[model samples]
Target: MDTLNSKKVTRRSFLKGAALLASIAVVPAAITSKDASAAAKATQAAMQYQDHPKGKLECSNCIQYIPGKTAKAKGTCKVVEGAISPQGYCLAYAPKA
Candidate 1:
């Protein structure tokens, strides 16, 4: 009788532990899927800005622009990759609001 009860308890504990591990694994996968989707959207937007258009539009006046860490270095854009110029413009350009 005692041996049978112990085996039941051990099996229940094992199942509980497995459920906890599965939940932990699932949470990260869900979060990563959201991140991947957002990354894809940003990449698609960047692709549209391949050429900087000519006009008064520039990075300094755009919302996605990030000023350089130093005065000599070029700035960057949220939708555009690589070093970006303050005077540069692209299709993703959006006036600061």
Candidate 2:
């Protein structure tokens, strides 16, 4: 009886561990898929910054723009990577509504 009980416990533990690993593997794939989708959208939008802006359009007024932590400094954009300037203009620009 004792031997049978121990074997059942071992199998249950193994199954639990396998289930945990499977869940961990699935979470990253979901996150990666979301990131890939965002990248695709950015590409479709033709996201790019211009040194000389086309008009009054700038990162500061774009919906994707994220203001810098401090004043008078470059900020960031949701679609564009790297440090972005508030005065910078990009093809992905969408007016803040």
Candidate 3:
């Protein structure tokens, strides 16, 4: 009978492997999630980002708007620099699904 057990995984080794995989999975997600907001934001003037709505269009309703602490509070935009009004409109606006 052969008793060579070279592949045995100890608790410490198992935990290390699990933690390595967990970190591998988490890092990609963190990087991807930031892809949208990490890019250099466009100047508000360049995007025609206004403090008021453009008819029915507005920042809160756009996909690029990052909400503030409150419903009506000013927020930031993924595509524009500086604080943004919830009612603001921009040329870069894309309706959220």
Candidate 4:
């Protein structure tokens, strides 16, 4: 009777499997949950609020107005330099003052 008794798993293989499992477990979190979406929508609504039919909130009035702190990864507006509010309705509405 011959039996295979010494088939051990390598460290590399174990590490790879562990990493794969870890990534799989975190994929859902990384894929933007419902709460995250709601927050994003709220922010968007906050910044989209214009005074008139052809006006804008700009960044000076935004609650989240972080001058020199906003970026492409923050929101959709390219005029402001920081993360302005979506419903941020301001009087000035300057470009980036």
Candidate 5:
């Protein structure tokens, strides 16, 4: 219809819409970065993950260990949540080649 085609968004209305979108965009970053990871993975207990090594096996030697920024810093598991110690072990362990 001509009436619909002729309508134009006002500057105030456009800015308000943009502001709302920008605020919505910023909300996700306010959440802890690890929250998403936690949601997507299993809990440490569910995987029977432990803070100590199982025999000679350890997280640092497993295929799923995602190393931290530093060697000694805690790492994360591909299938588990929270800070995983390098010495930790889990049923999901698959020795890295």
Candidate 6:
């Protein structure tokens, strides 16, 4: 019946595919870091964040808080995949640390 010839997908091929998938999963983190860094730099240069003096967001009081050495440390956001402005306010802002 030529079973081997009729069928494809060997162990090596499957492993290769699995490896490819693993690598693909890690790509987003790398990309996010790059994009986040760029965004942070731009934000710092342009000063694109407002202080909620009488509002909210104080590291331990932010939804996207990651806790850094400083209160303004860049952290991940629920809406944004990368780091978000500690003082940055968005529509998806939530009160959570």
Output the number of the TM-score-best candidate: 5
Model 2 agreement with the true structure over 25-88: per-residue lDDT tens digits: 9999999999886665353125667644568887888899899987558887788876788888
Steric clashes per prediction = 0, 0, 0, 9, 0, 1
Using all chains and alpha carbons, the TM-scores for the candidates as numbered come to 0.54, 0.60, 0.60, 0.40, 0.61, 0.34
Tens digit per residue, CA lDDT, model 1, 41-90: 34424555533545877777889889898754687778776777777777
Which residue runs does candidate 1 get wrong by more than 4 Å? 1-4, 8-23, 30-38, 41-53
Task: Single out the weakest 10-residue window by summed lDDT for candidate 3.
Answer: 1-10
lDDT of 4: 0.49
lDDT tens readout by residue for model 3, 22-60: 999998899887886666789989998889999999999
Clashing pairs in 5: none
- Candidate with top lDDT is 5
Shift in Å, residue 21, candidate 1: 1.8
How would the candidate models be sorted by TM-score, starting from the highest? 5, 2, 3, 1, 4, 6
Each model's lDDT comes to 0.74, 0.78, 0.90, 0.49, 0.91, 0.59
In candidate 5, what are the lDDT values of residues 1-97, reduced to their tens digit?
9999999999999999999999999888878566875688988899999999999999999999999889888998888888999999999899998
**lDDT tens per residue, model 6, 1-97:** 7997899898999999999999999999999998876665333224333434225644346565565567777665544444555666544445762
Quote the lDDT for 18 in model 4: 99
Between candidates 2 and 6, name the one with more favorable TM-score: 2
Model 4, range 1-80, lDDT digits (tens) per residue? 23455667899999999999999999889776855654543433344544233444444444434434444233433333
